[model samples]
Target: MSLTLRIILLIGSLISFYLCVKKIKQAKLKVENSITWMMGSFVLILMSIFDQAVQWLANKLGFMASVNFVFFIIIVFLLIQVFIDNIRLSTLNEKIKNLNHYIALKENSDEREKNVKE
Candidate 1:
């Protein structure tokens, strides 16, 4: 609600957005992964620039403090990010397991052919 806080949030969000872009340029982060960061920074900037929307939403949501609503949004976003990461990790693990199994089977068949030739 305070002007100082708003300025800080705006500056922080801008810095975050800039850094996210830099990472993308450097090929250190994929565009898909950076989407959440970009969106988060954009949301912070939006809430900072449009404080009235935050207040109205907080009122509608029955949150006495707008700050509480902000924190809730941040926590929920982070939780969703964590869930998505878990799903990605699970898929990667499954792919790795399948690859390893295929390699093992291939090696065994190759060994059998070699033995038959010998």
Candidate 2:
């Protein structure tokens, strides 16, 4: 491999390792999941460098010279999923805030009515 490819792989591996460690430390990811992520990252890095591997399969399966196509498609799909999840979370948050505000308003109105009656 060329020096540049070696450097890229090293950097990618380090980044993947760092992410796995961070996730584990934060309790956001289980050990198994972290390991999977780390392994996936390594594979992705390897695929990035040895693009011919993807091409060979693609050709065997009747895909064109667009080995990078699969990678980009996966990236776009993940990004869309992330965006959709973020939107859903934001909507739920807004609903919760509105419910809280409505409850507070109702409680205050009830108190006012009780005081007036007294």
Candidate 3:
């Protein structure tokens, strides 16, 4: 990354990490869910701090530019996060449907029992 870009990323990462901590403290974000954000910001901070090492690795990996490599990593991580969220949402949806169905059945059974008694 260029010097300016590196500085910008470093600042951004630090701010992100700080915000993550604040969110956890406020109980706005759970520890488990904030772990990924914290880790990602740490990685960015490492990259910013060790610019030379990142450049070397990017060169070895055949990336024309270190910025591209950084962006690629960010995109890949985001995709993975999105996939995980999709799975979680699907599971929650299934649970909600099952619960609704069970409630409906219970209501129907109760109505039948009451009518029979009457």
Q: Candidate 2's error at 88, in angstroms?
A: 3.1
lDDT string for model 3 (1-118, tens) is 7889989999999999999999999999999988888999999999988999989999999999999989988898899889988998999999999999999999999999999999
Ranking by TM-score: 3, 1, 2
Error of model 3, residue 49, in angstroms: 0.9
| Tens digits of per-residue lDDT for model 1, 1-118 | 7889889989998999999999999999999999999999999999999999999999999998998888888899899999999999999999999999999999999999999999
Q: Model 2 clash tally?
A: 0
Question: Best-fitting candidate, measured by lDDT?
Answer: 1
TM-score of decoy 3: 0.93
**Better lDDT candidate (1, 3):** 1
Collision pairs in model 1: none
**Rank order (by lDDT, best first):** 1, 3, 2
Stretches of model 1 off by over 4 angstroms after superposition: none
TM-score of candidate 2 to 2 decimals? 0.52
How would you encode candidate 2's per-residue C-alpha lDDT over 11-79 as one tens digit per residue? 876797888899899999889746655765666677666766666766776765544455564577568
lDDT of each: 0.95, 0.71, 0.93
Cα misplacement distance, residue 105 of candidate 1 (Å): 1.1
| Root-mean-square deviation of candidate 2 | 4.7
